[model samples]
Target: TVESRAIGPNMTACHHSYGRPDLLVYCCPPGFEKSVPFVDFELPEPPSPVKVRRPAHLLDESFIVKYNKALSIMKSLPYDDPRSFARQAELHCQFCTGAYEQLNYSDTPVNIHRTWLFFPWHRMMIYFHERILGSLIGDDSFALPFWAWDIPESMPMPDYYVDENSAFFHTERDFSHFPPRVADLDYTTDQNHPHRSNDEQIDVNLKFMYTQMVSGARKTELFMGCTYRANDGYCDTTGTVEHAPHNTLHTWLGSSLNPGREDMGKFYSAAKDPIFYAHHSNIDRLWEAWRKINNRRLDITDPDWLDSFFFFYDENLKLVKIKVRDVLDITKLGYSFEEVDHPWLNHRP
Candidate 1:
């Protein structure tokens, strides 16, 4: 079993309802000062003609090539460099593995997954990551791709990630899930559902999407999750969708062969894989689609939800603190998900 280090003065103890042991996380670690020495409070100006990220399956050869090049460069940088692949992956570890404390509530750890911080915190993480990747390749308008795994036609891992030579390729993934093989979104490590035919699988997938994305998320709290306040103990309530498809996909992608399932199955190592970003892009896209369902089904407008904040290092290596309010608009952030068909809207199981 994986165990976190002892809880320190700067850590927060987490409580869960899943019968798991309490977890202690580092919300902010010591010595890793939160800012770029030269930069002030605000982040540097974003590049003009902001990129419109599209589905990984739909990307052309040139974009794929450039994308790999950018990743390769990122991976080759020094481990100490904040923008390096190792350092970038550590950011995920820092937040998820208990490396930092909640700013004012240092004794209370920061757990972004089960609380309202999941979506916006990750959106900012990926935003800065995308920017850093683009800056490495001198492409101001470059964008990351979303894995359109919800669609039957795009369910398998994108071919770009399977190529052995591609920077996106990670040998740690479950090869049994390689393309032309569809992912089981509702997959569980301990349970097995009898195999279904392709048509049957698509039907199941669509119905599951509808159930998780719509029916299961009818209320604001049910959708965005419970709030985390300063000095609060570990957040135990996870939103419906975040608990379902979002968590399901993570376990589904982790290679069973690797102990602790580094890079995908576990939170601390998930970001180590390039495909993790695309996987999350899809999750982020679902958040966008959910809000557009109707006037009644919108994001939580709670003041506590909007005012919550998280910190991250920007492309320029500047540590910036952003609020949930700042990212409610993706357009203002200068990026958007490529439009795609929502086949699950009417697939009411």
Candidate 2:
């Protein structure tokens, strides 16, 4: 598994690119070494008051204030600090981009995207991120707001993030794609694509969400993505949700004028934007929603997947090694999404 290979001695940074092979995107953390021994992850006793992640658009003023303050604190920390916002964003880059390679497998990059590792890997990433934010604000129950793009009324970029003074704001985002401008879930980079009215776009988005979550994803592999191993090369067969609304929203929010769509469009820079977490929070919520949709729709029961692990710096600055099985239940990790109307639940296209 990638975990065993990654923890090996002599682990060095791997050179790689995002879209174009020539356009190298270097995101490896400075002063990284394999000398720090990783402590095995242990599931915590269920949180006393499980943090409930709310929709970004529906977040109350007090909650938004707290959220902004937490992010501000995170951003103020020195870049070298593992719990700093800078390093948190770089963590995503290191994994999604080819910044690390399988220890014994020569030149074989370890990427969590486009494979079964996608959901579980990201779930763990944000779990720690949320913890860091809550810790910064001195509130253990603080939760991240999710960009509820799947719903009709909450479709556009949340207004809280649009505030220039808020910590959620990212200047690199597409100004034209700001709030009130309904998002195109099927959005592509093609400039010539026709535009739709707000009502029309919302209608289309609901249908797209329905297809990705329901009829299109019936099996565990189809919903979560294909199997990926430590020695395997890139596995491009992304799950239905990851391919459409997940990937499309990234492109939709990113600045199209920028070279590689800095901030959100590219994996290397996606988490740099505060909205990235909210967006992924929704993706993570969809994973849970998908599971409840059908009794047969379940997580992959393969040992390789259950045993696969990733390293993360917790809110306490402890370098902990977490396994895939550890994050299977959000309640165990001390968080859950707020209940909301799933308009796309029955809107089968």
Candidate 3:
């Protein structure tokens, strides 16, 4: 099926398969000579996420009068024009305090892939924080849902903050303590992961999920790599392995990036923090469940990582500057996310 419209809703696609984008090629372990397996295809079946809890209140003035009547048909360009909305909130204040002073100054690690401006700067910081939460309830159709971190049951306690009773939360104090072994390198390596009293000790890489193949034309390996070699720690990246991708999770940061975690590239105040739009609506639902896993074969052609770029922090908090060509066009900057009737649990990593 694979229908259309995303983030705000109406996205039909019971399933479909995909292929070719340089047919999938990766090599870093001991400098390979050859390895191209995509094997033909078959890899969709890992979507079971929907756990957003923390609304309490705000948005009810009839949701800001039905979103100022959809912002009077949505349009706010000339605030003085630097490409206005007030010079894109003045380069979103050097992209959220210059990405928290270049990712808290460790040793240069920011790589949302060498840059076309990290996907239209987080799709114009999730379309100006979903149009300032749809201009505070006036309603431009309101859509915000990511937090599925690929599911370790939807992780929740990495030191949890944003008080005043869940004040529009959005974390990433640049959290740490991962590396039990994504091939281990040392962000202090071994913080002793018994997982602070076994929430299944990191829930086996969020339940497990990975299927990739194309075969003959070249190479492929993770016919379903489920992390932990053959399954022992079980699964746990839902709250930390720093959000997603390992066992060979290479977006290559989209393609060669690491100016030392440049504050993990903006989104700083996380759209006035309502848990940063439900943790980037579950990081845009794990980038649309990792492009409908395997069968959708993680598409993404890399013309310099398809011109990446990033900058965000909008809603009175300002900081805009986005591009990946305006998020490959998240439906011409509007809204469309649903999945919330509940019971999203077939489970996989």
Candidate 4:
């Protein structure tokens, strides 16, 4: 099993070893300086009626109002509270940008990205985020809406996120890539790349999605990412989807002028934007959708993969340690994605 430590009072500055030394990375909040105790995670009974996460484009005005209200309330909480929005965003920084080190290997950083840990870790992160959002609104059945960028009609940035007056809005994003602008699934940070019309871009995106989700992801390791075990220095291989649309979408939404694309462009500051949850909700849904593509499509059976763990502060502000095995099934977690037609499923490149 990959032994890990709960992020407590000992977090270090986030350093992107591969990036410019002068670049400043976001750090955990002052709240993390106070040692917090964590409890072993216990599986809760499935919700009475499974919470159905819908696409961002299809959300009604009422759903948008409720979501905006919940986020506003979460942001209003004291910074010391683990359930507060600032703390939650810092949690992503702690895990992804070398803020926490391995349990016994002080020199080795524990990074959840660019490895098999990517999916489950993010899944658990958003799971608790959704619960906290729902709890703030007094609605246990509320679910996070997904930005289904793979779909042609819903290709652009969702409308609700771009509303400047809404709580979901974040300032540090590329204004040129707003709604009605079809997202390039194979987006590149190179400014010189040629542009395509909406029809052409949609066709290209659908083909790209098919390649990433189908032809490119046939094996468990290929779909999930490279294995990362206890004391491993760093595993840099990422799954196809994680490499493209996932990372691409981040850079696409992030402000081009920022040092490292603040908010969505980089790991340390990604969750600072409220739309981060919606983006990840779609990534989580893709994991579920990928498994159903073939009878042989299954999760990694390695004991190390199943037994590795991470820590998170739940909706009630109680720190909990949860294993990867515990989050393999979304249904058991009391939420599911609403069924939708995947046009990209048939658009082979």
Candidate 5:
């Protein structure tokens, strides 16, 4: 059976079709970096302008009603609602199609900048989507949560995520104990057939980011994973963990996908999937936690970093573009979350 399991909210690896046993194992690009041992990132809390109440996980039964309402509208949608899923899909189609056409297809090695921008842009996109969910659930305090991947053992899998009956619970699948390489791989250009194995490789890149450790280019590979060693379509087969890299549904979407397998931190092709918001929310939560661990990591403080963007839709199904600057002030959007009591902050290893 195929394991089309989800990673974290809205994102799942669809690796069953390639004759691979699981999507969990991906091939390494050239110059594969050592895997960083998964470590629990903990830190003192950072003060926020907004009152940080309990986390979103502790929301009550009523929240589920709103969650389902918003989610249903996002996917299947309501019969009377003007802003339905069909409208959203239609708008995206016109926008993406028009955008793709304006570019020069005649150029060799034509890459889509839109594809590159999709992940971060979608981050904000889903942020709003979840907000609608929160509003519908009647708890402005809600935020879509994520699946914590850095923990060492028994990380959750898809089988346990969705249960129409249950009120709230997480799945099971530990990243730390994930399968390692089954046999020695011949690090050659001809190495093609891909499979996965489990090992005890320690990741040096994560150590650098979470801890104040130092790592060089090898650290890059460590940050990404095995996909670094495998030959990317690009000849620059330098091995290192990459971020915002691969598009899981690029073939299905027939669009250009990013090349990454690093921390799943930055951008990912999986965001197009409806659950992208939840996976990223977990990622964003970790970012919040990391900021507390180390002050420097706080929300995009870079001057020229282009950290913000916008997303909206029009009546005629045209994709509306928003800038990062406008939405940065989340408070002005007229929403606040009621603190969660038992957030999955991963206090226990």
Candidate 6:
């Protein structure tokens, strides 16, 4: 219902000091300094409702194989193709690294993170990403599998993404955190923390989720994040869930050998990794779950927040525009998270 203004101007490209040095090679596009009209148009409604997107850890072998095959087809596409895997990944780098400008806002930079748009924007992102993969495999019902890392048993990287021969595999992830190794939910760059037993770690993980999901994020602003209006420029705050396990996992999975933790560790390169989509799918599910907590939590209602918009190339590689409103009802998009045990909902400590 709401249309987005032009994306803001390209901001100065910078790098996080903690990231690998080699990643500096990526720069804003040559003519990206000038504003370009982001094509805006409505897409025809889907012929049917979206499919049920399931957790990566819970996927059957058939689903896993189909998922991998879709990715393989996407990866095999020519890089110059808008729907190609390389172009798909580059969309992350460009938007995140300050390549576009907000429309009608004097070219102020428009970064998706650290603001309310983070959730809806990313939802649209993976939505199109899933569509692209599905179209490539000629399976309109295909959906992306989420990484349900909150579950203790599902903490390790899903085997579907780790096989070396799989197009989903990326060598940059932390080898020490591989399967048979549970994730440290509160992990930081700090490497000196004393190791705890698997039982102890799982206990710690559950407690962290309890605190983050219930205690820490009890309201809209606290849960979804601060608002960003036109001319607000890049956001200064990040939402609660986006801050915790979301970021911690990114840093933990980053490759030690690659500069700036190619693919997973940094925003500019994260989408390059196939696991990035899975990780985000889980994050998206958390948003749905967050709303059902006590039936008190709800999405923010600010018009500016609701009006925010973003663009993505659909499965057909045709440029299409989307608004934050389009994603509020995932069912309309024809997708829903697979039902999983919500042990964290009952956790109190």
User: Who wins the TM-score comparison?
Assistant: 2
lDDT per residue, candidate 5, 1-349, as tens digits?
5322111110111111111123223221112133222222111123323322223334355645555556664555552332454433332332222211111221112111232223334445555455455555455555565433333221222222345343222122113321331111111113483332323212221232233111222232232222110112212222221221122212212112222222121122233333334444543443334334444332343322232232343222233444434344435533233332222232221
Q: Please give, for residues 1-349, the per-residue lDDT of candidate 6 as tens digits.
A: 7654433333333222212334444534334344445556453378865678887777898888898888888888886677888878877776665555556553465777777777887888898898889888888889898899898878888987778988888887878778877877888766797587777888888888988888988778777877777775565687788888888888778886765555688887788889999989999999888888847447676667766776677876665767776678777778888789877767779
Model 4 lowest lDDT segment of ten: 5-14
Give the local distance difference test score of model 1: 0.75
Query: TM-score, each model?
Result: 0.88, 0.94, 0.24, 0.93, 0.43, 0.88
Candidate 5 off by > 4 Å: 1-62, 78-120, 137-139, 152-154, 158-160, 164-274, 289-294, 297-309, 314-321, 327-349
Alpha-carbon lDDT, every model: 0.75, 0.84, 0.32, 0.84, 0.31, 0.75
Tens digit per residue, CA lDDT, model 4, 1-349: 5444332213333333432256555465564545568898887675456889999999999999999999999999998888889989988887877776665566677788888989999999999999899999999888999999999888999998889999999999999999889998888878797699999999999999999999999988788888887676687899999998999999898898898787788877889899899999999999889988866346687777787787788888788988888898887888989988999988987
Q: lDDT: which is higher, 1 or 3?
A: 1
Candidate 5 or 1, higher TM-score: 1
Tell how far residue 39 is off in model 3, in angstroms.
58
Regions of candidate 1 where Cα sits further than 4 Å from its true position:
1-30, 33-47
Candidate number that wins on lDDT, 3 or 4: 4
In terms of lDDT, the poorest run of 10 residues in model 2 is 1-10
Between candidates 1 and 2, name the one with more favorable TM-score: 2
RMSD of each: 5.9, 2.5, 22.3, 2.8, 15.2, 3.7
Candidate 3 lands at a TM-score of 0.24
Tens digit of per-residue lDDT, candidate 1, span 196-293:
66677778889999988889888777887776665667666888778877787777787889765555877877888889899888888888888888
Query: What TM-score would candidate 6 get against the native?
Result: 0.88
